[model samples]
Target: MAISEIQSVAERPEGNELAGRVALVTGGTRGIGAAICRALAGHGASVAAGFSHDRERAEAFRAELAAGGADVTLHRGNVSSAEDCRRTVQEVVDAHGQIDILVNNAGITMDRIVSKMADADWYDVIGVNLSGTFFMSKAALEHMLERGSGRIINISSIIGQTGNVGQANYAASKSGLFGLTMSLAKEAAFSLKRAGRLEAYGAGITVNAVAPGFIETEMLDSVPEKALERIRSEVPLHRLGRPEEVARVVRFLAADASSYITGQVWAINGGQEM
Candidate 1:
């Protein structure tokens, strides 16, 4: 059989089979995060999507996803705040007994040259991108550790690896996530081993990161058309990726199919880095 046929079969997850599984996606109200939420819910995972503000938008998204027959919950909280992170996680646990997947996709960008950037700009980017990931991961780790099976997928960016100009803050924040992914993977592995759940290695939990490039989202709506065209032209694939593309990768990581893959970064940038 062709690889596409195999993938099609594997992607068809039954609703009842994933009825009990719960997933938390940070900043899931819009863009790539929103896509991830829909993808996970479509596959039968009960979803909790976190948003920093705009309750109306969040609710609308929830209703839309719910209408599609996906169990979805919307939680409002600032991922950068430890207290909010704790509350968000608690809310999910309160609604559902345990968390099976955590998608740390909340992030921000305050673009400016390092020499001209204000300290606050740098701090804000790091706070949302790096610190937020830590806070959410810490909150989710408790339940995941107990379950002995979970998946943590962090959303990173290609700029984090290539170091974009006028985006030092963004680059630093994302690069930091790469370190966190590896470190957490090692820790989780050790914890699983100590708990005598070696067989649950990939099943229990696997943490990974997905770094995207030039995704056409609201964030990129501000980019000049000429610049975007240039960027698109540079990609070997000759186009920017869709939010759904990134979402599919997260779905795979969250599902049992990708049990053997962990602590890795999946770059979905239309082969830009390569």
Candidate 2:
């Protein structure tokens, strides 16, 4: 299908479901992260969209979001750095008073077969995709622990579950998120119910992941046309997933409706098998 023929999955948010909530979405300048940021803001959350670089695009994204009536700000930082992650979290809390939702959406792909993979390629993908999630989650959990309740939504990939050719490093990094999700969910539950210093979050907290497959985004621009067509042909839904479709799922997980769901993976893959 032509890109223009693909339907949009824009939000029709209602009831201010996330009103007064404060959220941070890393890699929020474009693609899935951008959609997630807009969805949260549309529901009345104060959002901080973080980008690693590309000042021009980030500024453009900021202006577009501002025009949409969102209470949004932009944060620039590299999530792979523990110190940077700590400072980013602290800055958000300092500005917004508290962070109730943390979407670990920052990631990258250094696709290569194991034999040909460079040292930097392996470490770079692992650092940004896996370690970045941990760094951000660790820093955010501190504030969430003290606050008594919170949400940590990790953005993983379908490759993590079933694996993929030329994606050894990517697969490993993403697969690691599932373990991290389950572990953190348990720890947060412990802190909330028993070991916690703050009793306000006795209501509990949640940590979950969203693993999307072949979303229609510029991320796939580098893929060859024939390969892309083959991917589309294999999907049970007969098409690529839309970014907003995935964002809606993230929004649901962030909302009160998903309060009971945690340590699980929600695959948004157009019914496609990994």
Candidate 3:
């Protein structure tokens, strides 16, 4: 499908699936992150979009979503820093009263072969991708446990499942999320049970991951047309995935209906790795 056509699909149907919930999305100003924010807000959830830089772009995004009648706000912080993660989560809670959803979408790619990859490149990617997810999840879990409910959705990549060249760091970071998701899921479940609230609140917090394969985002803007064509050819659907497609999965996971699912990695790769 054409990129414009994919993006022009109408907003999600108006609903109250998450009307009383509050969501905080990291790196939520653009690309897939922005789509997740829009999807959650469109579903009637109050959204707090977190950004690290580009104040102008962040403000524009907030304005656009707010204009659409979304109860959305912006928070600026680097997810790589534990302090920043804690502060951002607190800011969201302070602003909205509670955080029911946490989307760890803030990530960076430092593409380079291991031989040529600088230490900074490796650490920076890991710091923001994998470590950031952990920091944010930890911070959000505090609130979730206090309330006995929440959703933690990590935005992983298909590369995490199927390794790629020149992306060792990126691959490793994303793959790490799978283990983190499962472990956190079990821990959250056990903690709630120990606290004698497992069955008290049927909507306890859930931790899950999503792996998107070759989505049509700015990340692909610099790739050669031939490379893009090869990517498309490899996908069974013959087209790159859309951000909204991934966002829908997140929306589902965020909903109360998905309470039975946890620690699973939902793939949205157009059949590339299935």
Q: Output the number of the TM-score-best candidate.
A: 3
TM-scores for every predicted model:
0.93, 0.92, 0.94
Clashing pairs in 3: none
lDDT of model 2, residue 72: 80
**Top model by lDDT, which number?**
3
lDDT for model 2 comes to 0.87
Question: Can you write out model 3's per-residue Cα lDDT over 77-189, one digit (the tens) per residue?
Answer: 98899999999999999999999999999999989889999999999999999999999999999899999988999999999999999999999999999999999999999
Q: How large is the C-alpha RMSD of every model relative to the true structure?
A: 4.0, 7.9, 7.3
Q: Report how far off residue 216 is in candidate 1 (Å).
A: 1.3
Full-model lDDT for every candidate: 0.89, 0.87, 0.92
213-232 per-residue lDDT for model 1 (tens digits): 99979999989999999999
- Please identify model 1 stretches exceeding 4 Å from their true place: 1-17, 200-202
Model 1 clash pairs? Answer: 148-204, 149-204, 150-204, 150-205
lDDT of 1: 0.89
Candidate 3 structure, TM-score to reference: 0.94
Write the candidate numbers in order of decreasing lDDT.
3, 1, 2
Candidate 2 Cα deviation (angstroms), residue 256? 2.3
Ranking by TM-score: 3, 1, 2
